[model samples]
Target: MNRPPLDRCTDGLPLPPGDDLDSVGPFVIRCVYALPRDGTDRRLGEDGTISRSLSAMQAWFAAQTGARLRFADEPVRTVRLPETDARIADRGSYVRDRIERLSRRQGFHEPRTLYAVWYDGSSTISCGGGAWPPELRGRVAALYLQGAYDDVVCAEDRFSPDGVAPEINEFKMLHEILHTMGFVPPGAPHHTRAGHVGDNHNDLMYAGDPPWNPSVIDPYHQDYFRTGRTDIPDLARSSFLDPLPAGAEPPPVW
Candidate 1:
């Protein structure tokens, strides 16, 4: 894969992680900025919005679970789509799938690597999408940045006791990453047909109403993150966590 100079990326993306495939650990999240040939490069990944949101996400995760996710070595990177804006932007339901496949072709698909693409392109689809573990073969998820185009940074004051504050972008990106990681297993008490917690609208994994008000990750602590049971899968045991064991296990096949 061709990479721009270490100091900056192509089309002015944030400084990208080095292209050292031999060194990146398994089960890590790779952040990417994606747009089509004719699409404008907003460079949100560098302009502080994405960086701040990631900080908030890190804070939220560390606050909730006592560990942060293992992001790709470089905080963020960029990918220029092969197609023109018209062809890529209007993919609708196929957008995530299309982008994931395309990213794989660009060499983003390392074993156990989950993609978190911030697509700066329009789509008829919803704000974001993630791969539900049970049905996942592709290990990628994406946020349609054009939807709402929200840049809400974490409301620090309101986020301490409960993780309510996050840029809607980080919030949704985390949600998609969780989904791709096979969260809210079918055996979870509140598992829904939509692969979310059916019981709490405030829970991050809940499939709730408009004006999404997610505040926590499995408030019950019995579903996905740190479920005290061994019968069902647990994210606490996932290799995606920072400080995770070296040569960590790959994500389980659901």
Candidate 2:
């Protein structure tokens, strides 16, 4: 569905440096609305949903890490997938492998940029996928939004006022992006079998059967954000974070 002109709360928010450059800092998280050949383009980028939602995400990110995520710029990026919607759906469960197609683009494949992709395509679930930090083969976090466009992209319509979807849509994207950023490292105290937390179902990175009622990030601080443990990676130190904290160490070149 096409959005009406947006009177979104995109103004007056605490936005990071934006020049619309593909890459500028040591690390960046670029937002992209990727569409397949047969998919209808919704122009979520131009309409301010992506820009506004990501701003909300940064607000939430700061609450957790005291630093903001370094966004490439406003008016989120857009790309056309090499395959069709139907072809992408055929491999729905392996969504990451399919969405990784973006990494093939020179612009998207910059080693220091992690792409938070809103792929307008089909998948088995309201699908979102991220790479484990150790699995640094690709730097992409994708959400299959073909069916949940209204529920997810028209986030303001579904939940909250002012078109910000920090609770659900944008939160899901942040969860996936954190995963790609090497959060909830395997050695964390609550690190579930692998990439997520199992201590609390309400935890942002929980990977269990409980309701995904995410209200906080690494609530215990014993896992990813700022556990203060030098053994495992801490998200507070990720170079992708803007205004990097003092002496922040960049993650491996993914």
Candidate 3:
């Protein structure tokens, strides 16, 4: 299917840049790992793994969009968040509130592109989880903070000791970030309408968990950013979190 010019958002919003993005220094997205108080055995924040994952993801983004992603050499921040329900409704706010709290406590940096991944323990369910308002299901695996395009919620079960590999977890993290960057493919009708990359299971942005190796950025996502389309759904105002509060630090600019 042919990719359409991004006209998905009923609301007017500016799509984040992909190719047009020029950075004085390499673009850096800070990732803070907030561990659960009753944390389990997930080692997502391990230095070697985290560094390698960031390098791999950065390479992919650079190869696809001509954007440079600089990984922070410092250790990932370990934080504590008040416990909250795992349902999507609560999870969204929980992630945002934590990001806000961390920002206030840690202070903002320049060239704003920050992500906080809250780590729970593990997911018992192999299938997805959701009830009323079907949209609220297993989306907790990871989510791009709808409007901001900066923050993301990385759910607990995204990794596994038995089967899932480190690179796989990294791929999931990269996938969610793409969503935030407005990588929803127009060629995928369901993804365009349902807010997931569903047309091809092989694509990194696939609605479900993709493989450990990760796929290249879909062509439509490339086109959307390359063409600088500014009307994508991911840029729409979030129906979830309230806007940033007053006295909030502004995001860093390039």
Candidate 4:
């Protein structure tokens, strides 16, 4: 009855409220703002873009998982300095330091803070873009923006109070949030009988194409939560088997 050598995380993911070991409660998201290394001169529209992005994320999570994901009501806290190398392996440390500083400022001892950064830079930092899950020490979910705040929540002429006006899309933000919540990597143990992962092509974890809406958390993901499986794979540096030859069958489920 041996198990893998990976560490077993006791944190309640996919659902919060860790008191009952199965209790589902709201997870706090302490939104923190940061600029790129050279973009300090720019003023961020925290109230407009950052606020909408977080709201949209909350809506998506609630619709998909029935779990309430909460955050600071207003955009009051923000990083004084730009994050150093937010797209690299050290991104977690950079984010963690900011969160700690924020916690100290608030004078709260133990608020579950997921450092949500409204980055004013290009997504090239992390190749395309993705969230740095909490499993990675110091890391949390983040939103990457290539342009100014207006690009995130602007209209044909001015700022729009409607909702998240993402320049790229909302899927990226949703994808990363799921990652932080212990969603399985794109492979077996998470796929369907047709070898499809993420419920289907419409799933948030799908490898490509298809927009974010209409996606959901399939039963496979539920199994992960219901069965108390907490070994969330670090997709950033996870080891894998060699690729199969052309026309060959896929590798067996790990």
Among all candidates shown, the one with the greatest lDDT: 2
Across 117-218, the per-residue lDDT of candidate 2 in tens digits comes to 887777644456776655433467876675333354332323123544474777778887877777678789887745788778777887766655777888
Q: Residue-wise lDDT of candidate 1 within 5-112, one digit each (tens)?
A: 101011222212323244554567878888877788988667755666667788888888888898876868888888775676466465666677667678875655
Question: Model 4, stretches more than 4 Å misplaced?
Answer: 1-27, 40-47, 80-111, 123-135, 147-161, 164-168, 185-188, 191-199, 208-214, 219-254
Model 4, residue 189: C-alpha shift (Å):
1.7
Stretch of 10 with least lDDT, candidate 3: 129-138
**Candidates, ranked, lDDT:** 2, 1, 4, 3
Overall lDDT per candidate, in order of appearance:
0.65, 0.67, 0.38, 0.39
Indicate the residue-level lDDT of 45 in model 3. 61
Q: Against the true structure, what is each candidate's TM-score?
A: 0.78, 0.81, 0.50, 0.51
Tens-digit lDDT string for candidate 4 (191-247): 432212433555555542342343454534432223233343422211111121222
